[model samples]
Target: MPRQPASFLPIADALRTRIRAGDWPVGERLPSRAHLAAEYDVSPMTMQRAVERLIIEGLLEGRAGSGTYVRTPRERLRMVRSRHRERRGGSPFRSDMAEQGKRGTWESHSQARVPAPDGIAHRLAIQPGDHCVRTAYEFLADGMPVQLSTSWEPMAITDGTPIVLPELGPLAGMGVVERMRTIGVVIDTAVEVPRPGRATQEEANMLGISVGDLLMRIERTYYDADGRPVETADITVPDVRWEIAYEIGIEQPE
Candidate 1:
């Protein structure tokens, strides 16, 4: 058997070492692929893959026919902290928009008995195949789509509420928390879990973006006084429109 080419790691590592050692200063062009291949004693195809890996890692950028250059180290990510709890109000989506002087509206699509999705079922403490009243809505801020949400409530509890009514005005003026309060269920705390996910084809079309563009998936769950779960909502917001915040509480030494 003969030794093959096109493995990228060792080549990438060598280049990474040079860049980290300040051999290639910020905004400097690295040697061309043909040049790197000659220097590293590798074939062009193998050298190309190694360069591609660096580009994907944000350590390098390729300019068409111009050449590859070392990218200035840019912050990969940032977190915003707001100390005043008052600034962080209820309705994480709408409240933030309102704070920034953005008026928004919600258009309810429908509310009906539908089986919960696997994740929603687990959060709501319901069986995977169990029935639940699902409410879908589109949220708009300043006439622009901001978020799309679908909420699930176990049928046993919502069957007595007006959740299934045909009329499609806001389910309750005071929002989900208030509506549940009407049923003697008071939610004291809620948590939102967000993750990076690719927008579905339909979502990309509706949101005017390329299919599989980056998006944020938020799953919010509200818990009642007895520590029982009351509501679970899945929200999708465009990456440009929403920001996330977290509060960490410390426990005193026992």
Candidate 2:
């Protein structure tokens, strides 16, 4: 689809100027939606959309049952993931964000048994139309969303096992390696390929950012010792809120 111009961009720009000029100082309440609509000669819906953009930009805050107001900006923080092989248990978030003074948390939605598309099936080395358990996750840092991830696992490998639901049962949230071990799957390796891209409107909305924001997209897969593909996931992280660093170890040859 061709890129469509959002009606709120100009409005957002105007409001941003006012905010930066101190016309509406931090903590000042913005005019009511109706008032702004009349001022801008647009519908209230368009005005609301404009305000929402500012809110996502950290320049405004909307109070529940109350009006929107200017918000004091907070320092932006970045999260890290170390590649040290020893750190292979529960989510890296627990250790990674914790060390950076943020409490890391994640919530997953219902797990579904669905037919794998040809591409996903190929990633898992399963037949097209084969069943897989799919789960979606939103990861947070100190209560603010930081990442979105969706994982698919071949039911042929996890069916009839406690680890079928990646985020449930005995080993919930324990990361992939430990969870697979419970079912006798020795996860020996994981592969990740990260690509940078601009976020679409849907993804922008979910991450509380404006459309076309830069983001890091990572595709990861886990393989067992026997070279069987067990799981794969797509992870998206907002570029403004995260920086990806790769740490590699060098080996000496005798």
Candidate 3:
């Protein structure tokens, strides 16, 4: 048997219709939960649930010390993933933002000599306890955070090299491919797997979105010319603000 929809779903649908009909204009505050509950003859908790559903769908937003309001629709920016980007030499992220006329910046914290756990070890083809350098980055466009990444690189590959710390040395803020080249490691290829997920409390706080908002999580690994994994990272992007685009190159017959 098919399960029936939740009681609040109908109310949510009605609220959505009202919003679309301009019952309240964009940026206008919604009526209080208690008032709506009384109007709908339901409990305040039920109305709250319905309102939350709209918020998650990007139709509404909540402000601290204020009330929920209709959300002003935001333009979704595209983040392109392609081999051509890697070949651009400088920071790919900065270049990406520049294409959109937005200033790109990031803050990163690198921890040295961290032990790799089982999952990270498998990704890097190293022992579970192998020492690695872990770096966490918050990427911003126009001073607003839009992406997050945590990367791990085997210390054995860069232990005594000048590029040991990703955010330090002469190539500070350079990408993985350029940084690895400084140590004689030729990064030739990369693989990325993207999955859809919900934002956790921590991720929500970082991205300034509601908990349980949609997110795109990408698992990426870079390989050397010899097929050895040089770096692995997990990247997070909020789906509400960004879209992922892939560029593929096709060769013509000679």
Candidate 4:
């Protein structure tokens, strides 16, 4: 015999059907969990579990000191990754947001002369324990947190340079490609590998999503013209709110 579904799952399915049937309109408050439990003839705990599932599905939203409400649908934005964007000579992130009529901004914190951990050293082609510059970034679209990144760069390349700190100095906020160029380093390529993951508690807090929500983690590395790794970063994006799109160039025959 086949195993039975969890008790709350059927309840959740019924609630989803009702919501879709317009029993509660968008932005309308849902009835109390106790009332819902009595109506379903289930314990309050089971009702809570059913409601929480819908919340995670983005069909409902909870308000502090208020009841859960039907969520207004939101449009998922696209983040395009392409070499053409790097050639545009400005902040690619800002350009992306502007295309969608939203403002793009980021807050970053940099720590210089930090020792590279084993994993970071491998990515940057440096020895473990070598000094490096580490920067943490929180990116926002229209003042709402949407992405996060942490970058590592070898200190030997930028220790005495003006672009040592990613978000400070005259060349601040110019992205890795431009900043390295200012210091006489020509960044020719960047490679990114994306993987699916579940959000941890800390990540959930930062992106304003529930723990265990789906996310995409990207490991990106930039290389100089000589093929030396110059910078490496781990970028995080919430999968539900954003779609990662890649633009590839087709080579032309000479």
Candidate 5:
């Protein structure tokens, strides 16, 4: 193994970019650590740090009997949701994004507008056939995928807003709570439900793991001041690299 003198973050970021760009397509096996170490001209430990960072972000998963694999959008989002639930009274998105951006050097990994899937349609509380704007992004922090997010907004509402043309100009931030503000829908509260299960093929493909791996599923719905369901987000997090801690506030007894 060689030392780059440069930090491992850049190496990790570049590797992640390759994956996001289809250099390492979904379900594709990556090279061994020794190979990666040689390719990046870094020590094994430094390469390990880069891999660990992505693992912590729920983008990659390693198995006792198998190698690492790319995680799915669902698993990545679940990690973000779990962390958001744990941290109270602040902007969870900003905190998470800032940390993640620092890792991958804040480069855009992937973006696309696709039709919402069935599960997403149900969560958004829209009709089965309704169309929505779906955007998926792989964000890296310190050169790894720390966050994988997919956002869906009803075309009916967003079509009228500047968000309709995201590539043309700057719109709202990635978070639904923040994005809603652009449409005069302020999110004052969020309710979350958490479920646990084995990872599916789709999840395994994205997170770079095998099916049946442990995963945490989180469903979050945002509400406006008038109690309207403004947005719903579903997230799946791999159990290996990510964990959420919660603190509850208690009132003093009289």
Candidate 6:
């Protein structure tokens, strides 16, 4: 077979080099695809592919009727998970942001008596048909979305209690551990498991990020002293936007 046209890889590498060398400073528009293709000695489609790769990496952004330009780098924030903050005031996220010298806020929508789905049922250790309160939240720092969450709590634990609605009453915005206290439920332990994931279209919309971007998902469950699961939540953060950290003290052996 005859030699085929050069692939987009070499073109991408050349463009990447130019970007890093500051040949085109941030906010400077890249030449049109046809122009770039002629300059790089590649087909316009190949050149377009190279620019798209850069766009996904957040190195460049495209504007309608305008060319692509270098993107401004955003500073990634730190999200700390220090167990001690569970005892402090406000929500857990608020405490974390405070420690990072930022203001935190959240918006939540809750549905009462919603039937538990299979995934939520498993997390709460309850039957699929069990009644639960489902809450979806978007948490932000200084008006920029940083986290997204969906939580479910079995009504069997808080039904008919003043703390049924998580963001309501005098206990509003108080972390789960404290809100459960009003109903005589002594939450003794919590568990969290985090894994890598890709942002869904909805998640990306909520977090103001691109779809298919990396995300860190944390599955968390709160338990009463009796070892019964009381509530469960899925917390997701854009991987490029935050540095997740954990702190635990070691036990000294005698």
TM-score for each of the candidates? 0.59, 0.77, 0.85, 0.87, 0.54, 0.81
Q: In model 6, which runs have C-alpha deviations exceeding 4 angstroms?
A: 1-17, 26-29, 32-34, 37-72
For model 4, the superposed segments whose C-alpha errors exceed 4 Å read: 1-23, 40-58, 61-67
Quote the RMSD, in angstroms, for model 6.
4.6
> Which rank order by lDDT, best down to worst?
3, 4, 6, 2, 1, 5
Model 2 accuracy (lDDT, Cα): 0.84
Q: How many collisions per candidate?
A: 0, 0, 0, 0, 21, 0
lDDT of 1 by residue, 98-182 (tens): 7657775677655567877787788988888788777777777787776778777788676766644322335553466656666
List, residue by residue over 2-91, the lDDT tens digit for candidate 6: 966348767877898899899999999988999999998888898998888677657789999888998875567777776777878568
Query: Between 2 and 6, whose TM-score is larger?
Result: 6
Best by the TM-score measure:
4
| Candidate 5 positional error at 9, Å | 32
Candidate 4: deviation at residue 209, Å? 0.4
Distance from true position, residue 156, model 6, in Å? Answer: 0.9
Q: Which ten residues in a row have the lowest lDDT in candidate 6?
A: 3-12
Candidate of highest lDDT: 3
Per residue, candidate 3 scores C-alpha lDDT tens digits across 1-254 of 99786778889889999999999999899999899999999898889989987886678899988999998656788899999989988799998999899999999999999999999999999999999999999999999988999999999999999999999989988899999987889999999999999999999899877676789999999999999999999999999899999999999999
Worst 10 residues of 1 by lDDT: 77-86
Runs off by more than 4 Å, candidate 1: 1-93, 163-173, 247-254
lDDT minimum window of 10 residues, candidate 2: 79-88
Query: lDDT score of model 3?
Result: 0.92
- Which scores higher on lDDT, 1 or 5? 1
Which prediction has more favorable TM-score, 1 or 6?
6
